[model samples]
Target: MKPSYPLMLTALFGLFALTGCGVVAPGLAAAPPTPVPKTHHSAAKQKPRTPSPVTVPRPTSGNELGVVPILEYHMIGPTEGRWQRTPQGLYQDLTWLYDHGFALVTMQQYESGDMNLPAGKHPAVLTFDDGDYSQFEWNSAHVPLPTSAVGVLEAFQKAHPDFPVTATFYLNNHPFGVDSVAKMQWLVAHGFELGNHTYTHADMSSLDASGIEKEIGEEQAYIEQSVPGYVPVSFALPYGGLPQDPTDRTAVLNGSYQGISWHFLGVALVGANPAPSPYSKTFSVSIPRIQVVDPSLVASSTRYYILSGYEAQFLQDPSMLYTSDGSPKWISFPQNLSAQLNPAYSSRANPEQ
Candidate 1:
């Protein structure tokens, strides 16, 4: 058979464009991005858990930790760079998540007991690290460019409508490579979160207690100065490093420097599998993050390992994954994994019996 040259060329062009090849579709102008709603930061819906008329079945064996996959991304413009996701790839991710009933939530919400997703929808967290310029920047029209990460996310939300438009951005000193104050304030005003990634992206493990405090304190100070009243409760470790001393964990969790207080309920790691629910006994300071990268860039074993591993179970046997039935007071999961859940949040009924 003769080679389909046109089809082959189109596919090649798409593949190239995904890696920052700078290809624009001929004669296609992007529509202006939808204006983000100025909802109060605390407006997250929380429904009271009441007794259900119908009994919800308990899973015999499956994802029981109410595993909320927290995915991490570094750059958004190119697929070729390590830990970077192309614009098309990001859209594909949102589409897959929306189609599969995944509701987006902030790290703060995931750490809290007040989850309010639509019935039967699972929660996931989208986190961007290093605050790359490609994540969010204003164009000549002073509007968010559809090509940036924020722009792509807004466009995706508009197209899907039900997908949550929330994300947590962990920042270094040079936030998003734009006007730090404007972008940070914009994020807070528009339902997005700004988190500390250390002032200079310092490796915590190498730093002494004073150094670690300085690293964290300086970044927290900048954020407070830039966006008053926006206290950050989530932290992403620089280079995914933890301090050598056990006491350092407490410092990261709750510490004060130069009269400014800082605390975090969730501290993210550099790369690994998805995190179990915050209510899980296994959950801790070392929250793992799945890097958003093209498969070719990572080892075959690590490529989309978490998503591919849990996605099928989430769709067909959702009870295997962490899901809320309008109740945040008690932990929900399979009987087999009962031992893994935090006793504080586990159901009173003994799963062992």
Candidate 2:
């Protein structure tokens, strides 16, 4: 029998308290909990699984040091809203991206600068936040609904095998309204990733050091418990709220609560334009994402807008976009623009004339 949402929450809350933390109500401040040694075994401490190698056509020329867009999405439903993208709109977006030479890649691949694509093809990161049920749902037969986000992605991938179905879903408590471990396992079993969005979606800016740790650490614990050996390498700040204190900010990047520690390689923000190439010096752990919403809802710097939307900007000057060199063994870019490359990737840098 499938576990009910309330029972799941009860178990999660019990684990939370046992970890020397208290359940934080949304928007309400809670007293700092004492830190205790983590007694629960976690596979998160183990090394993350390496992605399988993909073969693509070698590129004769392309810029590997250009910006890559990390598109942020919320709900996938019938009507588009400020935080929702209609299924039809999503299909259109995928079609447009594919036609424009954009290939789907996970946030992990983008952050690690390991996105290996065909010659002249750019990498695009798709991320879903909140983990709404509309984003993923199974019919009575246990198959993904045709209109759901996962279903759409699967269909698109079937149509275009080159555009692999891979994305990162940032989850909060009661993800997909079920909090089912099977759902989490299924996502990981496929190519999709599960990331942390805090336990209660608390605004980080309002949280103190302990609160911050509790929020992040509890979620980490939950994920580790739900999906053994699967540790979220990235963190998406709730409401894109960044802690004001420098130390608190550091805690967000790396923190521990009652022995349940978390170290995120990448921290995602709420809005703005495309992120700098991982090989670029401008790239950092704090990554910016472009909100995928209706063009009419937002004035400028919105989706589908030619003058202000990031899509148009990239289309206007494809050179500014990161085109894969088609090989993970080397990072390729124009020698003239070599100065922009981060020195850490110097060993793999392959600047061409």
**Among these predicted structures, which one has the highest lDDT?**
2
Q: What TM-score would every model get versus the actual structure?
A: 0.76, 0.81
**Which residue pairs collide in model 2, if any?**
none
Worst 10 residues of 1 by lDDT: 26-35
Error in Å for residue 287 of model 1: 0.8
Query: Deviation in angstroms for 46 in model 1?
Result: 22
| Count of clashing pairs, candidate 2 | 0
Cα error, residue 327 of model 2, in Å, equals 1.5
lDDT of 2 by residue, 1-353 (tens): 12234433432332233223322222212212111223645766777788666454334588998988888777888887666788888888899898998888888878776677877799998899878888788876657777888888888888998778789999887787664577788899998989998988877889989999999888888888898999887888776666777666778877899888887768787655578788787677777677777778654422332213777677788899999877876788988889998787787778885
Question: Model 2 — which ten-residue stretch has the worst lDDT?
Answer: 26-35
Q: How many clashing residue pairs appear in each of the predictions shown?
A: 4, 0
In order, what lDDT does every prediction score? 0.67, 0.74
